[model samples]
Structures are given as C-alpha cells and as structure tokens.
Target: MAGGDPHALLAAAADQMGKPPEGTPRRPRVGVDLGTASCVLVVLDSSDEGDCPVWVESAGSGALQDGVVVDFARAVATVRALRDRAVDALGTELSTAATAYPPCIPVADARACTYVCETAGFEDVTLVDEVTAAQRTLEITDGVVVDVGGGSTGVGVFRDGRLERLDDRPGGGHHLDLVLAGALGVETGEAERFKRERPTDALPILTPGLHRIAESIRAMTRGTDADLPLHLAGGALMIPRAGDVLAQYLQRTVVTHPHALLITPLGIARSAP
Candidate 1:
C-alpha cells in the first residue's frame, strides 16, 4: 500500500506554502485537472513529507464540457498540451500523471480520466474521486465538504471521520452568471466578470442563486445536520459572502478556505501512488 501527502501537494502547488523542504525522489509526480472551464496540470517533487507541487499550468478548454470527456481527441490533445507546458516549466519529462473524476461517475467514464492521462504520454496514472480528493486538502473529519464547480455542486458529509453521505446537484458559478446576466441584461461572460470583481455589491443580487446552492447543501445534509459543520471547498462559492450566506441559510457554521479552487485538484495529486 502507498499514500502521498495530498495536503502538502496542494500547499506546494499553491506556491509551496506550508510544506516541508523538498526531498530527493525517483521523479516528480505530475497531476492534471480536467476542469470544465480550464484544464490544469501540476508537478510535485515527491518526498516522505509529501509531494511538493513544483509547477502548475492550465489552458482554457471547452472540450471536457462540464467534467465529462465529450470530445475525446480534443480532451486528449488538451491534456497533452497542458502536460507539455508543465513539463517544460519543471524542466522534466512527465512520464506518470494523476487525474480525477467527479463523484458518482460510472466506471467507464472514470476510466476515461485515466485514458486522458495515458494519452498525454504518462506511463503511470492515478485516478481519484473529486470529492474525496477535496477531503485530502480539507481534512474534514465530521461535516460536509461541498465542491461547487461551474456546472455542478458535489457534497460529501462525513461523520466521525468517515463519509456518510455523498451527492451532486447542478447549480453553481454558471448558474450565478445566468442570474446576473438576466438581471443586468449582460452576457454570461460579462456577468461572470462582474460577479467575480464586484461580488460584494453582487451578493444581494445573487442571493436567490446562493440560496439555491444552500438549499442543495441542505438537501444533501438533511440526515447529518444534527451537529455537523459545513465546510465549503470549491471555486464557484469563493465569493466573499457565500459562506456567510450559506451559514445563515443552514443555521450552522460554514468554513471557507483562502483558495478553494485548488483544494480538490491538489487533493487528487495527494492521492497518487
């Protein structure tokens, strides 16, 4: 059995923060995140303390189309492109890479994630579930960890250090953009920019959208809400007032991270063998 430090990998991937010094290893571990909006690749200089993410790179990709590999050749080429760029950044060849899939995906589709890495020329591949990967970074013992991606929100509730509930509901950043677009009569991209830049002012306007997400969380945590806290680990809800809004909606404590988007991808790297 083998395990790598998902936490340290995440920390270092985000500029080597909170990691032990790099150590000698056979080779650096590479990770690729096939996201809906972008495809990201990360390299970790693995050690006993954990693999330190030495480099991170991403490219805009519409090929995956909401976490599913709709266009196989496009997805593979995207992965390869990101892989080559990351290898160049780290000055090493990426022979082995780890990738992740969203929760509840079928085996065949999950295998596609590995195939993407394999097609990218990695001899070794590791596959991790997106929610479990996020936990590697959050280390949530007893509570819910919600990952709000552009198209869906995946929730995992843990009780006494074990996951008790898991589910996914579609409503996230893109949904918020839709709400903003309708209200302001702006394009989705413009609304996305507005929501990101002026989130403080956009909070009240986006309340229903946030509540929709909160309600989804409530639905996911119905059985476990007795005393469990809610820990948010995703990019879509990174807006400043999101946690506060969710806390008020759920009538429970909500935890937010400094850089939520990197949590799961880094966690996936940590899950490498």
Candidate 2:
C-alpha cells in the first residue's frame, strides 16, 4: 500500500467492482470477507506505485450469522464461486488470501472463517479482526473505527496507529431491516431492498436502530477519548444521512467515507502477507 488518500483507493476499488481491470495481475494480494449478509472477494496487484485493484466480486448470500458460519456448505459454495470467477477473469489461481471475522466472535467461529476460505480453494489463509482490517485501509492514527456490518458492530480505538481498545456487540443492518419490515408490514427481503433503494424514507424509520448502535459505541468506547472522531466503516451505515443521525445522537464527530462498504475488504487485501 502507498501513502495516498484512502478515499481514492476506495474509489479505485469501487470502479473495479464488477469489471476486471486491463493487464495481467502480478503479485496478487487477495482478501475475502464472509459477511453476515454477503460475501466479498478482492484481488490487488502490487507495483512500485501502489497496490492496484485487479478484480473485485461479491455475492448476496446470507451464509453467516453474527460472525459465525451458520451454513458451512453455503459459505464454502459462495466463496468458491467468487474465487472461481476471479481465477477466470485474472487467468491465475489465487492460492493464498487474507480474511476477516467480526471482533469478539468465539475463537471457533473465527476459525470457521479461515476454514471456509481454505475449503473454497485457498491454500493458505490469514485471519484478521474486521476493525483491524478496516484500519489497514483508513490508516487512522488516533481515532475510533466502528465497523457496522450486517450482523454486528465492532469498535476499535486507535492511538498513534496502535489499537488501544476493541469490542463488539450484536446489532447492525439486519436489525435495521427488521425494524423497517415490522413498520412497513413487509417481509425481511422487501425491507432490505427498500432500505437500500429508499434510504431517505428508511432513515427516519431506522433512526432508533441507529441510535441503539450509537449507544453501543458509547458503551464500548467508555474509557477512550471522547474527542477522537468516530470513523464509520463497512456497508451497514452507508445509507445517506446515516452519519448525521449518529453524530446528532452521540454529540461527536462522525466521519463516513464514500464507498464505505469496501473499507474492510480493501483493508483485508492490504493485510495479506
């Protein structure tokens, strides 16, 4: 990775989401994210300039729950499909990759993420907590990184580029979808689609759920400096005006990046050894 604007890197990653970039990959760096509501795979090629994204792919499959691999076969199948597509596009076999688990999941659950990657065909896999992975991309030296994924929110406090405190609790996008579902008298899937497509309307309905997440952040970062800005990572809080809701509720600075969903997956690629 190079010392450039992290947002630029995210924009680059976003542009290559579905389309494979031109040129053959060299020294490929790979990252797999087994998210609660989706699975994402990123491949980067290292050069003197920096790590450039080559291929990025994702699958909308709910194979995990709360950082645990609930459906082992489905998880493996999803990762394998992603891996196979990357191989087809890049014309190279990705033998090793890094992956992440939500912070504070049971050790066995975390290991299950690695196993899923291995079973999906990676010969070697590295495991990282989701918050640390997000830091790899944001490169925040002295602040907080909060990863609001599908199943849970993980908070990490950093000082001088070193992590000081880390914690996680269950409550995230899925819960918000549930709230929307109940309010609209619709099914979970419709609620999710509405939340994505009609976020403006959804924000009002989702405020309380966002507040609950804010309260979780408040409790988790209790001893840390309250002045450090809260950086929002992951896809859950990518909804428009979501950061404003959090900032108003927490009375603290909340920084939300564009293409926020790519934060962790991109960081995970940067983390690959």
TM-score result, candidate 1: 0.88
Cα lDDT for residue 42, model 1? 62
Q: Quote the positional error of residue 161 for candidate 1 in Å.
A: 2.7
Estimate the lDDT of model 2. Answer: 0.93
Model 2 misplaced stretches (Cα beyond 4 Å): 1-3
How many clashing residue pairs appear in each of the predictions shown?
1, 0
Candidate 1 on 1-273: residue-level lDDT in tens?
A: 023544444455666533332433356766677887777776666666545566666677766655678888888899888777665555667787778887776788889989988987888998987788788777788888888887778888887778887887778787888999999999988998998899898888899999999898888778675567777886788889789998998899988877687887777766776
The 10-residue segment of model 2 with minimum total lDDT is: 1-10
- Clash pairs, candidate 1, are 6-270
TM-score (all chains, Cα) for each model: 0.88, 0.98
Query: Model 2, residue 137: what's the lDDT?
Result: 93
Per-candidate Cα lDDT values, in order, are 0.76, 0.93
